[model samples]
Structure formats: C-alpha cells, structure tokens
Target: MTTDAIASSFAQYVTESPTAFHAAAVARDQLVAAGFTELSELDAWPTEAGAYVVVRDGAVIAWRLPESATATTPFRILGAHTDSPGFRIKPNPGVRTGGWEQLNVEVYGGALLSTWFDRDLRIAGRVVDADGAVRLVSTDAVARIPNLAIHLDRGVNDGKEIDRQRHTLPVVGIDAAFGGTDVLDWLRGRVGEAVSWDLFLADTQAPARIGIDGAFLASGRMDNLTSVHAGLRGIIEAPADGDHVPVFAAFDHEEIGSSTPSGAGGPFLEDVLGRVQEGLGATRSEAARAFRASWLLSSDAGHLVHPNQPEKHDPTNRPRPGAGPLLKISANQRYMTEAKGEAVWAAACDAAGVTWQPFVNVNTIPGGSTIGPIAATRLGIPTIDIGVGLLSMHSVRELVHVDDLAALHGAVAAFLAG
Candidate 1:
C-alpha cells in the first residue's frame, strides 16, 4: 500500500482503539476478516497449515503456519504492547466537592500530565455484567481536567509541580438537584448493571496528519500502537510459503512493567507456543530446540532528537523522524539488541529495501526500556529492539513522521517472512 493509504488506515485504527481491550478486539476482528480463524484456549488447535488467532483478555496472538512447517520449525515473532500511559478510573469513582462532581482516577504510568489539562476526555474499557458477560464500553466526551486560570497562578508559566492526587481529578458533572449523581450509575445505564470494570480515561480527539505538506502524524497512544499496527499489517501481507511460522503478539500492561497475566513478563507467549508445538506432535526436547532457534523482533517506539533539547540525545548517533525506523541499543541490557540480533535486523531491512538508523541515549540521561529485555528473559529467545522514531512519546498526543510509519510496516513484514 502507498504511504498515504497506510497512514490513513493507521489513523482509523488509533481512533477506534481507546483502551487495551478495544485494541485487542479490533485486531481480532481485522484478523478474522482476513480469513484467520479465532481459537479458544480450552479447545484443541489444528496442526494443519493455516492462519489462526487467539485473544486472552487484553492480549492477542496470531500466527500463520507454512505447509513445510514441522514440530521443530522455528518461529519469527513480532512483539508489541497494547496499553499506553494514562489515568485509570478508581472504584467508587464519583467525587463531589463544593457542588462539583468529578471522577477519581489513579495515575497508571509515566504520563505527561500537563498535556491532559483542558482536553476532551472519555472513559473506555471492559465491563463485566451480573450475568458473567464481558462487554467493551466507550463513552463520548463527558469529562475534562481544566487547568487553573493564569490570573490565579501567575507563576504557572514556570516549572510548576503537579500533585497527582489533588490536581489531576477530572470534572465530570455537577449536582442538578438535592440528589447527587454517581458515575457508576451512568455506566450501568449504558452497559446494564456492570458489577465490575477496568476503565481508563482517554483523549477523544481523532488522529490526523499535521505539519507542512502533511509530513507528520499526531495521535494519542502512538508510543506502541504504531508498532502494533505495523505488525498486524505485516503478518497479513506476508507470503504464506515462508519456512518458519510468523507470529504477532501484542500484550497489555507494558506501561506498568508487564508483570500481569497478559503482560510480556508473564507466560502467555510461552504457553501458546508450547501448545502450538504440542499440536505439531513435538516432544519436550523438540519444543526446547524450536525455542532455541526462534527469533523475536521486539517493536516499540524510540526517541527522536528533539529540535529544542538536542543535548538530551547522543551526539554521534542521533536519529530523526522521516529518515527511517530506529534500531535501539543499550549497553546495560536495557534493550535486548546485540551483535547477532543487529545483523538479523539489518538483513531484514536490507531485504525489504528500507532505511534505518541507530538510537542510543546520552551518557547523562538514561533511556526507558521496552518489552524486549523482559520477553527475552522470559522465553530465552534472541530478541532485537526496533521501532519508528517519535517526539512527545508519552504525551496525551504524540508525533511521528508519515514516511517512517509506512517504512516500519515493510521492515516488519520482511522480518516475519524470515
């Protein structure tokens, strides 16, 4: 597909995915539409060559098996996360102070809290009803966290510290009569007696192309969603005749250190891979050998050299947007990329005719890590970290080059094709 077409489709995907649950569900629907059969964890899987997908809560894993595949055939996996940094609604979320009703929320991850001020925000996530049914729920713009007036705090132009507990509550409504309103009641009205929920607050703005000649794309949750979309497109467009199995695994809770059941640090990927090997009639030793031969491309967003804060990036190996995707490196094992893994990614990019650059942090400023090291430790598979460059990575709205976004899809497709 053309770069413009890819950008357009990605914008729609980001708009439709406000929470991790929505992201997983959207990916499942797209895979099913592409002739991939959905599987249940309790049911027996087919060993014959075909396309299959399975979803576990907010995580989804899909794979395509080749006709030449065997019990010991290796896998080429592309990994990413579905969750982003934001605020999650607390239980008994309704709060009233001086006649104003607000929603109590807890900070979920490392968020740029200032950007969330005065934005149109909505609540989105999964809800469990009394009948033991799980339903996805998304609401319109119904709440906002308005910033203090400049006149009231003239020093706000300087570096002002924000209190997560006292300053981050979002106003949702006001008491209309003697009785007060509860946010849970409003949610129950929509989803029918929701007994429990895993809801989060998200920006309601649509993703769009901005900057000169539409050179840039801006959207929320692009930190990892960009990689998720690239992997989805890569697996769908890859040839079915490759020698190895191609797998796409997007897990949740990466923002909070991926320790949950559906996170990369958990056993979700290992369990599925073991079951797949079992379906292929593999012995225990053969399964171990297959894992040893497998490779994982841990795809996540990387930082670009900021025009204003150039000193924060490595001077010699500075990466920029629109040039290409990034191959992240860290000497402290923060990233899983090594000499052998670098060669594997270089070959993939060369085979796809795509350009890429190296990304490293400055000596003074340490960079954040991705799911690469965690997954590598868990599965003991050779892994490499790679992604598109972006600015404002953890903000409510993030920015990325349109060309880099499309090139990432090509590189991931090449990697998945082995």
Candidate 2:
C-alpha cells in the first residue's frame, strides 16, 4: 500500500480501538476478514498449513504456517502491545463534588497527565454481565478534565504541577438533582447491568493527519498501536511459502511492566507456540529446538530527537521522524537488541529496501523499557527491539511521521518473511 493509504488505515484503526480489548477485537475482526480462521484456546488447533488467529482477553496472536513447515520449524515473530498509558476507571466511580458530577480514576501507567486535561474523554473497555459473558463497550464523548483557569492560578504558566488524586477527576456532568449521576447506572443503561468491569478512560478525538503537507499523523495510543497496526498489516500481507512460521503477537499491559496473563512477560506466546508444536506432533525436545532457532522482533514506539529538547537524546545516535524506523538500543538491557539482532534487523531492512536509524537515550537520562527484554527473558528467544519514531510519546495524543510508519510496515513484513 502507498504511504497515504497506510496512514489512512492506521487512523481508522486507532479511531476504532479505544482500549486494549477493543484493539484486540478489532485485530481479530480484521484477521478473520483477511481469510484467517479464528481459533479458540479450548479447542484443538489444526496443524495443516494455513492462517489462524487466537485472542486471549486483551491479547491476540496470529500465525501463518507454511506447507513445508515442520514441528521444529523456527518462527519469525513480530511482537507489540495493545495497551497505552492512561487512566482506568475506579470502582464506585461516581462522585458528586460541589455541583459537578465526576468520575474517579486511577492512573494506569506513565502517562503525561497534563496532556489529558480539557480533552473529550470516553469510557471504554470490557464489561462482564451477570451471565458471565464479556462485552466490549465504549461511550461517546462524555467527560473532560478541565484545567484550572489562568485567572484562578496566575502561576500556572510558570510550571503547573498536577495533583493526580486531587486534580485528575474527570467531570462527567452536573449534579442538578443534588445526588450523584450514578455512572454505573448510566453504563448499565448502555451495556446492561454489569457485575464487574475493567474500564478505562479514552480520548474520544479521531486520529488525523496534521502538519503542513500532511507529513505527520496525530492520534491516541500511537506509542504502541503504530507497531500493532504495522505488525497486523505485515502478517496479513506475508507470504505463507516462507520456510519459517510467521507470527504476530500483540499483548496487553506493557505500559505497566507486562506481568499480567495477557502481557508479554507471561506464557501466552509460549503457550500458543507449544500448542502449535503439539499440533504438529513435535516432541518436547523438538519444541525446545524450535524455540532456540526462533527470532522475535519486539516492536514498540521509540522517541525521536525532540527539536526543542535535543539534549535529551544521544548526540551521535539521534533518530528523527520521517527518516525511517528506529533500532532501539540501551546499555542496561532495557532494550533486547544486540549485535546479532542488529545484523538481523539490518538484513531485513535491506531486503525491504527500507532505511532505519538507531535510537539511544542520552547518558544522563534514563530510558524506559519495552517488552523486548521481558519477552526475551521469558521465552529465551533471540529478540531485537525496533519501532517507528514518534514525538510527544506517552501524551494523550502522539505524533509520528507518515513515512516512518509506512517504512515500519515494510520492515516488519520483511522480517516476518524471513
């Protein structure tokens, strides 16, 4: 697809995916529409060469098996996460403070909290009804965390320090009845009475192309959703004739260290790979061999050299948006990329005729971690960390160059093909 086409599709994907659950469900639907069969964890999987996808809660894994594949055939995997840093709804969320009805929320991850202020927010996530069935639900624009007026705090321009507990509550409506709005009741009205829920606050704004000449894309969840969409597109377009298995695994909870069942730090990927190997009639030893021969491309969004804060980035290894995707590296294993992994990525980019830039944090600034090291530790698979470069990462809205996004898709496709 052309770069414009890729950007347009990505915008649509982001608009549809308001939460991790929505992201997984949207990917499942897309995969099914692309002629891939959806598999259940409870049912036995087919070993024959074909395309298959399986979703586990907020995580989704899909793979293509070649006709020449065997029990010991290695896998070429592209890994990403579905979750982004934001606020999650707290239980008994309704609050009537003074004359305003608000919703209580807990900070979920390392969010740029100030960016969330005054934005149209929606309630989105999975809700479990009394029948124990889970349903994905999302609300229209219904809330906002309005910032304090400048007249109220003249020093706000100096530097505003947001209080998470005192200032982050999102105002949903007015308490005209002198009682709470009963947010739960409102939710039940929309999605039935739910016994429990795992809901989050999401930005209701649509993703769009911005900047002069439409050089950039702005959207929520671009930190990792960009990688997720790239992997999705790559796997769907990958040829099934390759010698190795091609897998796309997008897990949840990476923003919070990825320890949950559906996170990369858990056994989801290993379980699916084992099941696939078992279906292929592989012995325990053969499965181990297959894992040893496998490679994982851990794709997460990385930071570009900030035009205003250039000192925060590595002077020599500075990466920029629109140039290409990033090969992330860190001295402390925050990223899993190594010499061998670098060579593999170089080869993949070369094969795809795509350019790539290196990314490393400045010596004085500590770098955040990704699922690359965690997944590598869990599965013992050789993993390389890569992603598209973005600015305003972790903000309510993030920015990425359209060229880099398209190049990331091509590089992921090439990696999976190998």
Candidate 3:
C-alpha cells in the first residue's frame, strides 16, 4: 500500500472500530477488496498462496501457505487482539437521578480513569439484527460520555476511587424524559437505520502526530487496535510466494482472559490451523508437526517510560517511544519470548536494520497480560511478542509516537516479507 493509502486506512480503522467485531469486519473488507480469498470457519480454506480467512466476529486469521507442504511444515503467524477496554451497554442500563438520567455501563477491561475525564466520548460497535446479520455502527458525530464537574468531586484529586458499576457509568443525558428507549431510538436513527445489536461506548478520537517534531501519536484504543491495523495490512501486503503462508489473527476478550471462541485461549487458532492442514490433505499428526514448526508473533502494546514517573521504570530497560518496536519481557511470563524466540526476533530486526529495545517493569509493579503465552501453548510453536511502547495504556487517550506508527508498519511488513 502507498503512504497515502496507509494513512487513509489507519484513519478509517481508528474511527470505525470501537469494538472487536467492527474491527474484524473493517479489516476483512480491506483484504477482500485487495483480491485476497476469504475463508470461513464453516468451510475449509484451500491451502494455497494468497488465501485469507476471518474467524468469528472479533477475530480474523488469514494465511497464504505452500500447496505441497504437509502439516509438519512450520507456519508463520501474527496475532493481535481487536478488542479494547471500554463501557458495554448492559441489558437494563438506564438510571434517573438529580434530573439527569444516564446509560449505565460495565467496564470491559482495565482503563485509566483519569485520562477519560473531560474528553469527548462516543458509542460504537457491532449490532446483530433479527435476521442474524451483523452491521457495524458508530456515534463519531456526537458525545455520549461526559465527565462530572471538578467541584462536585473534590476528592477526585485526593485519589477518588471510581466504581466501575456506579460513578463511572457514563451520563448519557441530562433529562429523564430522554432516557432509555429514547436513547436507543436516537442511536438507531443516528445511523440512519434501525438495529438491535451489541453496542459499546467509546471515545471517537483520531490518532495523529503530535509535538513540534512530530514525535507522538495521541489516540484512543491504540493498545490492540493499532496492532490489529498493522497485522491486517501486513497480511494484505505480504507477497504471495508459494508455500509461505501469511496468517493473521485478531482475537477478542484479551483484556480479560481468552476462554471464549473468539479469544486466544479457545478454538480460533487451533481450529484454523487444523483446517489448513486437512484442506491440504495432510494427516492430523502432520498438522501437529506443521504447527510445532510454526512461529506466532503475538502483537500487543508495551508500556513506555512515563515522564512523570521516571523512578518507576528500570534504569536501563526503559523503552522509549519512537525508537522502534519494544521487546517485552516479564519474569512471570506476561510475555512469551524464550531465548530462541528473542534471538529470532533480534535477527529479524538486524536484517531489517530497525532499532529495538527491551521493555520490563520496575520490580514492584507487575505488568499486565497479553495473548503471547496462550498462542505459544496452543500452537506449541515458539512465540515472540512485540509492540509499540505506549503511555497511558488503557486510557481513553493513549500516547505513542507518530513515527512509531510508520515504524511499526515497516517492521511488520519486513517481518511478513521475510
């Protein structure tokens, strides 16, 4: 893809995807338009070059494999999550108090409470209709979640604890008469259509270059969504050389744990790999061998050094924004890079002439989890996870380097091309 095209595509992804399903749909559209073959879970995909398939609504795993290879041949896989931590619409989610009724929401994952304050919030997600057809929708043109006044919550500065079930439920309206059903009707009309589907409240912010030197990117849901875009593009752009399968997986439920069908811990990856082998007329044992020789790059976000909390990061391992991709390591296996895996990644970076750094948290505060270990265990393949280092992770507005955006594209493209 050209630079102009990449920018436009990234803009569309940043604006359209507020949930995992929508992200997968958007990516599938792009890949499909590029003449890539689409596969489905209901049917087996032919094991050949240039074939791509999406699984579930929240995840997509596409590949271009060698036609003659048995299941014992190793596969190259890139994994990224499509979901973001935000407020989900509850079944009964309306409340009226103090002449202001709001849409009560459940927090999906870990979110930085303070970053959400005083920012424009919107609702966007996939809505399944009665006919079982899923349509993607968005509220980018309006504000749905607004912060409470500082005067009302003086303790906010003294470390106010935000109850995900209560205080954090976004105030959707200032009038009781305009609550509940009215809000749903308004949402249905906003899309210029009527639909009943899963909806998630989110921030409708665009990711862009910031700072005088174009050093930063301020955006919403950059954690996994950024990786989602990169992986999709990588798969689409990778050359269709025979026998070198290019696979992509956009998983859901990563913010929590991966037990669902769309999660990393479930049948998504395994089922797809098995199908690929079977479609190629290989035996089950051959499929196991092919998977064992494979490599899965679990793409997720890493924490960058915070300017305000310099003391909280390790002195040498602090990952800087705009440097390059971050090689995340945790003693507890929050990341899944083994010694051989690291060597493979290091060699990849060296071949591409791209700079890289190690990321580790200060000993006191443990890091969060990614889909790394799950992919490794399921495939029994060596795995290495890398991502753009970020600040204000899980925040409504996360910070990254704009250069890092292009850097990620280049790195991922190089990885796929190899």
Off by over 4 Å in 3: 1-8, 47-49, 141-144, 174-181, 185-196
Alpha-carbon TM-score of each model against the true structure: 0.98, 0.98, 0.92
Q: Per-residue CA lDDT of candidate 2, range 1-418, in tens?
A: 9999999999999999999999999999999999999999999788899999999999999999889989899999999999999999998888888888889999999999999999999999999989999999998999999899999999999998889999999998877366656666776787788889999999988988899899999999998999999999999998988989999999999999999999999999999998889888899899889998999999999999999989888879989778899999888989989999999999999998999999988989888999999999999889999999999999999999999999999999999988
Residue-level lDDT tens digits of model 1 in 143-216: 89989999999999997999999899999888534466676677678767788999999999999899979999
Task: List, residue by residue over 25-59, the lDDT tens digit for candidate 3.
Answer: 87888888887677766764555544676658788
Off by over 4 Å in 1: 176-180
TM-score for candidate 2, residues paired by index = 0.98
lDDT of each: 0.92, 0.93, 0.75
Residue 194, candidate 3: Cα error in Å is 6.9
Pick by lDDT: 2 or 3, better one: 2
Worst 10 residues of 1 by lDDT: 175-184
Pairs in clash, predicted candidate 1: none
Instruction: Give every collision pair in model 3.
Output: 64-245, 64-246, 66-243, 71-290, 72-290, 127-197
lDDT for 395 in candidate 3 is 85
